[model samples]
Target: MEPSSATVAAYSPCGSTAAVCRAVAEGTGLAWDERDLARGTRPEPVDPGTLVVLGAPVAGGAVPALGLERLGRVHTAFSPCVLVCAYGDRDPGHGLHDLEAIAPGLGLVPVAAVLAPVRHVMVPALGAGRPTADDLAAYRSFGAAVASALRDAGGLFDLAPPPLPPASCPRERLELGFTAECDPAACVGCGACAGACPAGCIPADEPYLTDTARCDGCMACIGVCPVRARSLSDPARLAAVRERCVAGWEGPHRPRLVMGA
Candidate 1:
């Protein structure tokens, strides 16, 4: 990669991935171009020597579907890239593999992949205010090492995704087919939930309507609703998951850097 022309292509559902992207950019000690996938921007094919940093949270045991779809539209030819997957304290399901799967098609060469543990938005009780000081330190330290290696090797960080833990995620979580509903009686019609729906499943005109067919069940509405009126259908069952997953997280999980041969 041309040391000065690196770029970060990112899709951050709750900002953890975005933070990780920026940390890596800082480590490169160069100016970086950023592309936000939510806006439907397809990144242009990068130059042969350009370095790319890819980032997103692990969702539904994979990279966010929409983000991956948009990224796939960008076709490049052997552009070096680093995959960064941020997840709520638990292991990052299939995120690294997801990025690796897309890299070849997108003209990105797999040079390295990093996993950064972040706060869980679903259950704030677990890993709150995470990607903490220690986490950032680890990320930057790894980033600097990768950058140095890339420079030393004349624009090559070619590395395979590390051997990650078995996904072992819940079947329900894997589907992500759940829909969120708003209790109009409890809703103040403040439009917070509607505006917060990432998939645009909520209608602004009605303010209380959620198109179940369009909802991807990201649960963003549940967190942003000030009135606390939005909820998934099976709250009782999912709550059990939150408790158990959080209790078992066993933190002090740091960021990782995997380099290729």
Candidate 2:
């Protein structure tokens, strides 16, 4: 079928990546749909004319495995796509390479890649602080650049070379250790935590509980919960969780280019 309008879909862990995707779509005046791959399913087949953009956050220098899996399923159906990796100040080598490896396998072409700044709430072992006005501006500027690129392929910003090998596929899984204790009394059984979880780790149905195995520790659930019942046990882990959860991030400097088949 012929592509109708540009469609931008993303698997955001926190909300920043989705925000960026929305910015690009809004700036470019294209149709946009966001799926919390953590909680939702991948989209169906789309036309070749449709511009498909997939975005994810970088966890420990790599894309979340679940996000990768969803992308893989839809990659083949969507070609000439835009790959965006959201991260803090750290380099985007692993994130870029991971997407590159998955692109061809999914029948999707990488058109461009970009690495942009995100606000990190959890103070890293080294860097810690709220994003400055300049930081926010930078993200918006990056969004504008992405918008330009979407409008005209050549208009995208060129990112610095990734730190890792172009094709190296590293397995840096997201570790969600216990940060604090959850107060069952505070949990009103609303299932908001389960619904908001990015990895679908938390089961919203009966026996509603968090499945740490699948949790990326984005804490979107905890943040969105109306009762504020969920809490972490480990302070360090909690900090890391907060960092991953609240860190508003951006994609690479440039969009990855997908070679035409």
Candidate 3:
């Protein structure tokens, strides 16, 4: 089957990376299906003839572990895949290359990759006021170009990228160790927290309990709680990390886009 359709499979906790997927989908100049994994969305394998626009944010200089896990669940090899990684002003390190390294094995034919800039999720001060008009414009154009390329290729496009940098982000496995709790006083048994959880770390039956061991402390539950029942047991850790990041951070990162080789 010839490739003509597009799908966006993204893991965005704070919405920045999701926006990149939107720009890329629109760029494909094709009606695209959105799989916003953060909002508890799951996608089925496609026809292998569609375009897979895979995207995620950087966590500790690599694609968020949960995102990477989720990426493995989706089907892509049969499709031409375009990658987009969103990161703070600081370097995204080997996150994009990490994704590239696995593309072919997943049955995805690599075509293009985009590295987008967004305000720092942890230390907003570092990449302040980003994904500005200029950034969004560039994202849209890049998406369009990739879409056009795939459509023109008629499923024949493939690019085998060089081996990615062996060095990963120094804190590739960095964990914030933050804890989340549901205040029974405030929680009304709403399933919002469980539903919004990307990792399904929240139990639907209880709906108030969090498996911190599995939770990455992305704070999705805290943000989506109806009564604001979810609270962080440890906020100081993130605050401290933010302070340190701002102390030595420098940026206003630039977007990196590459066409299929």
lDDT sort, best first: 3, 1, 2
Q: Candidate 3, residue 18: CA error in Å?
A: 1.9
Against the reference, the lDDT scores of all candidates come to 0.72, 0.54, 0.75
The better-scoring model by TM-score among 2 and 3 is: 3
Candidate 2 lDDT, 1-261, residue by residue in tens: 222355556666557666655555554444655544555675556565465666777765677677787665563344455566666544444776677687667666555554544543233432233133444454445444544554554422232222423532345654545432357767778777766665666666731466665565565676677877776557765666556644543322233322221
Name the weakest run of 10 consecutive residues (lDDT summed) in model 3.
159-168
RMSD of model 2 against the true structure: 6.4
Each prediction's TM-score versus the true structure: 0.84, 0.68, 0.83
Residue runs of model 1 more than 4 Å from their true location after superposition: 41-48, 155-173, 188-192
Model 3 quality (TM-score): 0.83
lDDT of 3 by residue, 1-261 (tens): 335678888878877888887887887678789877666445557667678887888876778777877777677556787777888878787778767866776687767888888887666687787788788888889887776665565445444442333444664556556667787777888788897788788888898788888877666787678688887776677688888888887676688788854
lDDT against true structure, model 2: 0.54
Q: Which ten residues in a row have the lowest lDDT in candidate 1?
A: 164-173
Q: Which numbered prediction scores highest in TM-score against the true structure? A: 1
